[model samples]
Target: MNFLIRTNWWKWLTMFLLTYTVVGGLLFTVPRLPILNETIRNLHFHVPMWFGMIILFAFSVFHSVKYLSSKDLVQDLFSKELINVGVLFGILGIITGMIWANFTWGEPWSNDPKQNAAAVALLIYFAYMILRGSLSDDHQKARISAIYNIFAFAVLIPLLFILPRLTDSLHPGSGGNPGFNAYDLDSNLRLVFYPAVVGWTFLGSWIAGIMIRVSLYQFKKDSE
Candidate 1:
């Protein structure tokens, strides 16, 4: 795990997979579903962003738990940078989702259960950043933010995955709506979709890794 996080080889893989994802997503043949039709092509980019975001956030929470147990500022830094990249992916996911909604749902912003839930989830993380900024003591900031990070992820999982399903959500796999599985009867979408998820997730991790190394360097310099 540490080698995968710290090494540079997979960064090349991230680039290759993402390049393939973009080319294939834009030009690949997709199902000719009713409202989804050509828009179903968005499945490659849109769904992958959420998958990446969720993965990043899960990693952040893992580091946050590690920080709490070890009382290690480095673990706290890992949690912070992970959340930073995770939030970026979440924002991109929302933008892409809104674009898809405009094309398929006829509006950029509807009161869809999942949409609202996603927004709320982002706001919770936004508050996490705010909480970190509001503190001056490094240890205090790390300790509080680490706890908040764990709780934010707890809320995020239910908000994005569970609550939307319990209500009438327009999003696939939620409410009464059929997911990509139902539409992707031929397995064509999975080819690019799965790669897209891994590529985006790796890309986010790469960015977070860079930030972690930079922050650790600065921390060491300050301590010295």
Candidate 2:
């Protein structure tokens, strides 16, 4: 028990679990006011999932940059793990957003710029994984994958944020502007929402780290 507790993986897992519990508990206890009511509840899950997805993708791109500059195999491994986790969060975010939209907007999906952009972003990442698999050699695979990851992120910026703002969306701040800025979110919502984002982002990273460690262990065992 002592040995397990001392491990870095265990420490991260413990922290992630504790944070999740605290955030979930607080969200549950908070009274739903008239202004936000049910939409506010969506914040406890939807917004956090998007934040987690962004964090994972950011790390994936960072490692891709590192791999290009340093040619490190470990960086390549980290990039792959980050993408795997990012994709999971991205899918969750989309599903949750779809549910939220159905309640708030009267439809499960609108051609809303945000929705379209999010779908495009997911497809781009999927293409990245496909590009990695197409390569036969390890070194070549790492190099090409890193390049594709960087490009995927570059494309993601516009798809997720920029393009969404250019067109009108049935979603918030759609018709003439982007939403969720300083003026859009009230103080009460920010209280629980911000912490939720942090907690979920940490949880996402924790999962990715565990996956990376497990992959390393398996690789070592196979090599031996």
Candidate 3:
């Protein structure tokens, strides 16, 4: 974690991959499927946003657990900032998904089970942020926020993965819908899709790292 905060290589790699994804995802040939046709290009951007969000949230929960055991304020800072960035990615994912849905599903929103579940999951995390802001003391805020972050993540997994699958969903891979794996047989898409995930995740981390550094500095300054 500390090393990533100061590293340059991964950041450079992120820029390169993102540039490639944007360029290739737009120009590259995609599988021509019924109804999907060209909108399948969204696969590069939309899916990666959620992938990055999940990764960021998982890291947030890990740091939340670390803060619980170690009682380190810095760990608490990491957890908080990670959620901040994770929520940002989640919102972007929703927006991009909506755009794709409008093109493919004939509407921006169809009350899809997974979409509702995702909205609920994000609200839970938003509540976590609100809960933190309502507190005054740093220690109390950190402790309570850490616990809430863990709980939010616990609820998040079920909301996103379990509840959505129990019913039908418009999203791929759930509710009797065949996943992209069925249509994305074109190796060309994978060439950019996989890197897009890594690139977006790294970009999120870079943003969170900046936030963490600023917050940490403020935290230390306020202590003195």
Highest lDDT scorer = 3
> What would the TM-scores of all predictions be?
0.95, 0.83, 0.96
Flag clash pairs in model 3.
Answer: none
Model 1: lDDT equals: 0.85
Listed per candidate, the RMSD to the true structure in angstroms reads: 1.6, 4.3, 1.4
- TM-score of model 2 (CA atoms): 0.83
Of the two candidates 1 and 2, the one with more favorable TM-score, higher being better, is: 1
Mind giving the per-residue lDDT tens digits that candidate 3 earns over 1-224?
Answer: 67798778999999999999999999998888888898888888988888899999999999989988998899999999999999999999999999999988999989999789878878998899899999998889999999888887887888887778788666766644445565554799889899999999999999999999999999999889
Per-residue CA lDDT of candidate 1, range 1-224, in tens? 25666578899999999999999888888878788789888888888788888888888888888888989898888888888888898899899999999998999999998889889988999999999999999989999999888888887877777778788767765645446565553567788888888999898888888888889899999989
Please state the error at residue 9 of candidate 3 in Å: 0.4
Better of 2 and 3 by lDDT: 3
List residue ranges in candidate 1 displaced over 4 A: 176-178
The 10 consecutive residues of candidate 1 with the worst lDDT sum are 176-185
The CA root-mean-square deviation of candidate 2, after full C-alpha superposition on the true structure, stands at 4.3
Report residue 201 deviation for candidate 1 (angstroms): 0.5
Comparing 1 with 2 on lDDT, the higher-scoring candidate is: 1
